[model samples]
Target chain A: MRRADRTLGVARGLGWFSIGLGVVELLAPRALARGLGLRGQEGLIAGYGAREIATGIGILASRDPTPWIWGRVAGDALDLGTLATGLGRRRGGAGVALAAVAGVTLLDVLCARALSSRRERQPVRSFADRRGMPKTPGQMRGAASDFEVPKDFRIPEALRPWTSAA
Target chain B: MRALVWHGKQDIRCDNVPDPRIEQPRDAIIKVTSCAICGSDLHLYDNFMPGMKNGDIMGHETMGIVEEVGPDCRGLKKGDRVVIPFTIICGDCDQCKRGNFSVCERSNRNKDMADKVFGHTTAGLFGYTHLTGGYPGGQAEYLRVPFADKTHIKVPQSLTDEQVLFLSDIFPTGWQAAVQCDIQPEDTVAIWGCGPVGQMAIRSAILLGARQVIAIDCVPERLSMAAAGGATTINFETESTVERLNELTKGKGPEKCIDCVGLEAHATATLDSIYDRAKQAVMLETDRPHVLREMMYVCRPAGVLSIPGVYGGLVDKIPFGMAMNKGLTFRMGQTHVNRWSDDLLRRIEQGQIDPSFVITHRIGLEQGPEMYKTFRDKLDSCIKVVIRP
Candidate 1:
């Protein structure tokens, strides 16, 4: 497919996933958290709820991923880490939910890395092989260090202490 | 043949030596049509070049007909009148490719030109110092020119040798300094060291449309020459250069300043004339940065500072902070001689400028030593000594 179409496809897929997660968390809160095997993750669920809502709104409204994908990756990572702490205090339910959060983090990291690399690898034509160009003499790296000879009488030689040298 | 050889500190002689010959494929043997003792040659005279093995030839600035071109030489032919720039280069080197022809990779005449081609960082110069290639200079009746095509500029047939002689070094060098200083059309430009380069810098500044060119030097003849060249001169011993600059520019001071004296040729009346050594190191080390201090004080905020002076290796106490505070733009480099000489020659052809007007002392080649002393003493109205070899 075309590059623009592929980009839009990724954006749409990411938007639907994040928005679905947001609506579910907002609607059920504790039950959704518990059903997702995060039995005691109240604080983490609340944070994810807010982040999901914001990411959902941004993704539906704007085509750019800078606002959407960035919030999803960063906000999900923080919420998942916090939720992992709460799950640590629970029983067998805790292990599955923590594992799920860890998987989400790995996916987010890989996507973020790919996106950043893509931006960096873009072509640039100017400012290439332009170092060490010849500059005029007396113009050093810093400001002008040249001092002008002062006006009026410079110190007369007769007054200076005369010393003979080789 | 006789050479003005340097024996030791303050010792020089005209002694018999074997004449030079065409030693390489690119070299051309030039019968010296004209050669003069440069202010820089005085460094070799004082044994400052540190290459004296009892006999070393000194003299680089020259104009002559090609006596013999090497077998491989292409552009130059026998009997072609050319003015040789001091910094010679082989055109096919890495440095030459980058247009830094002065420090060409194959500039060293002693070593094989292949040294630079093999990625050796050993580009040298003619008799400046051992640090530079230490090629023998052109003060003799005959000299070999390696890398002949790049080093020499072809003079126009209409112009006499005397008219275009200085396009080799001093004239183009001063022009480079002027252009590097970035002197504005209506801005005031101040030049230090009204020696030959300083004088030429003023002349070039006038041609480039400097509203006011103030030349700084204590030498009466040079100061007067600056005045004749239509520049306001600051005779450092007489005038307060800082005060005059402030007065002239309404406290903004000069918009651009050019230092032509470099590190070697800073001749001050306060210093002894017998040994006009590196005043730059002496002042900055012992007392204070005397002249540079003034340049800082007088130069306008965000002004241009051009230095064409020859500075030897390394010094401390350059006012690093002050330069940043003032927002000054600075450019400094060895003259791209080939770039500036052609246009300078055209000016002489058009009668728009006559730089030879500054030539005050005319002497034969035999008088090289004595003339060096005279110019060194700065005596008897000697603005520039022109020696006919």
Candidate 2:
């Protein structure tokens, strides 16, 4: 006899949900780390998710909301991470507390939602000037030194055929 | 009905041979009610099956009613319905003891049956050739089956002729392919053929929990049936099998691949579409080519390769090195008729699987000769054929 589809469907759906949860935990380190009792700078390791999500979203949301979206996202992400790890921890080097780590995780989740909402505006007065805004691939290439590129690569050959009007 | 005795190459005819009778202590006489013309039968017709003497009876896959039995035969009653497995084995031998009924010590025809009677190394089998045990097979209305208690599976009373018919060969062979390959939950299997055995292999794969099954066949009808069985069918005539398999699997390929067609069933490469056109060069003696090689090519590394297809010890041109390099676990042999029958019967009885689905035609016992010719010629739209006495 065939198995009930609903049973298997729910099981698979739950798996995807867990992946998202893990991703959230990895995005912000300092602020959320200690609150949830993420021990021994574990939150820093977990912050890899937040860093990836920030950079990914920053690259994707490079339109009219450039600074407003990416800037606020980068700033608040770092700020929330620091507060969760610093203020939430005991002044005299707080020991790892599960509740502390969880509290920080909840704050990071809130920070993500806040940043996603403000993600609609231009880059804030933080990073680079947003004037003339949404950069093309070539302009993004020109702005390359602003971000690290692996030593093995250079401006892509895709732009080599782009003859200048001058 | 007269038997089509194979005398020599291209030499055959009807023979009003002496009637068969129970000879062994555990023997039973079956007045064959239905028997199918199997591809193996063609081995005798084409003089390919060895040791076929002049007037040797020919046929293996069959079913009929128990007409008589030796007094020592306890399980089968007169008029009882039964389906006989192609290979016979006495459960007392060493091979039988190990549950390898196909390789039973008493079945090694070349050995003396009485010399080692108690600690017998092998036994004989019904017709194909003298090499297969000079005992006559079921090409006539009657046949004598030794080891009746251990060799025949009692068909369920409720099943129709079309439903329990192929329990004799194709059906069980397909199941054997699936089981031997160790098909498991979410396993992906590919079967090479759309003949009766291949079709059943596809069915067994799904029933055994293979998440995806790919079937390769050139015939339109057979390929369509494979698709109906929930397999992703590929017409090797039109598409590159390697490309299709690679596309189906995200490049890694299927976990298990079965060569149900054996060494002779592969349709010849580069053939025209017409039945006669595609089959012009393909005779009963045709050899299976790249299909086996292709199976090895597309199967996952370290996967199991199960061959339920019959092959003589004389097969050549195989890629042994590649098979070794890929770490393929190969398992092949004649079906351990005695070992698999009871469990397979229960599976059928419980409706876990229906083996008769492969039966394509049912004829009378007297039609044996014509049926053999039609099936051999691939003339009828027949996949599985049965004869009613």
Candidate 3:
């Protein structure tokens, strides 16, 4: 697959991740707040979920999600800061939640950087409309670098039964 | 030279095996430096696989310093430190041309036997059973690497063996698993098994942008390891995995599910596992695919199910209809090891990720036999075993 497709794939995956987490935050704000040691802050958690959902929607809608991806990076910073507040409460699930947030922050930063790099480079072919079709040998062959097979390249006697003819 | 030889089931010995020599024109003799005992090696140790002969030097995850090269060998010379991929490929073959080196057509020496069993022959493997070409393995003082130019990945001296050693199998296998998931930006990946490949898969999923990873296993240490790798863990013994997963994903289920535990899956409590064990003991089945059924059950509609685990022969009670009905994308196979090694090495060098996090035990070569049992039984929280010869 092309690099653009991979980047887009990751972007899309992040969007869905945002949506998934948003849904959880919205429906189970109490549990999430408890896990993050933000007890009695269920309303705030739910609001953040709404914001996450909106950013996720924006990313999914835009062909160029670089700005929204940057938004996610910003949101990740906010999350880290919020999780940092709960670091003092090492008991309960606070530590686990903090670790999880840190991990997700790293991913957000990586995605942001990847999209930024791609935006700076030449425009890549969009995989959006390329309906799933298996590439023929001709299509796949071009990317293969040209290299000469040694003139003496031959299957050894012991390994011949396992090898097929070139 | 001393090598770890498999005599029979539950029988491995560090014996005085003849040192490997360059036997093929494209071969090179590598003075083995670091080798690992893989989870798949347990399949042979348990006598689960057919065609394993006594005295077979058993190892595939290996790195060594090149000692000699044959006349036809290219791109390698003596004194080069290299990580050897388990799958052997003839680089000039059609499969290799397409970068599908794991399925290289002209690499397996016993292609007909494989063709008869699997309907097609895959690439030859090092130190695996004859079913995969029976090339003498690298769990020895020296190894004869066939297709040296294609199979061996040279590493610079600056990097330690632990950093690049896994390019041989598990690292790529896990990366391939994550790639095969066709992960979307917000995909939640649920991985079964917290072994080395599973840990690597968890990391790969995170690096590839998995929003959340849910790891399922029964072992406490493995679960803690998965948690350390940033995955939420569910002990299959204490909690209901399917129920918890459903709750975690709000009844929609995770978008990607990876089964890293293959044929020797255990669940003494579940009826499915009991049936699998009874059937397997009677030779009625060759595999126990409990994790596969769970994946099909818990994966979201149109989700991807990637199997990095190894399974041989036929499995019974698979939820094929459920998988088809859900429109799940299934991707499983022997890893195209050579395809991903270079990029992964670049990632390692750039500090994007460290591959050494999975190594829990490192020991001398003589301890190979006991360590195999320790790893197989999950003693000492053994996650990965690397042997220095």
- DockQ of every candidate: 0.00, 0.00, 0.01
- What's the lDDT for all of these models? 0.64, 0.61, 0.81
Misplaced by over 4 Å in model 1 are A1-166, B47-53, B109-123, B265-289
lDDT of 3 by residue, B253-310 (tens): 9978999999888734467876776577668998888999989988887777889899
Score every model by TM-score: 0.64, 0.63, 0.70
lDDT tens per residue, model 1, B1-389: 66666556556666777977887888887777776666666655544344345566667678888899888878999989888888877878777776666667667654453343434434455545545556676777777788786678988778876678788788888887877764444667899887778877877777666667788886665666667666777767677777877887888788788887654433333232112223322333222234555576677777767877765443345676898898766666667687667677766776666667667778776777777766765655666777676
TM-score, ranked from best to worst: 3, 1, 2
Docking class of 3: incorrect
lDDT tens string, model 2, B258-350? 887665553324321122222222342234445667777777877777888765324435688888898777777766665556665665666
Best by lDDT: 3
Question: Model 2 residue B230 lDDT?
Answer: 63
Q: Native contact fraction of candidate 2?
A: 0.00
TM-score of the second chain for every model = 0.89, 0.87, 0.98
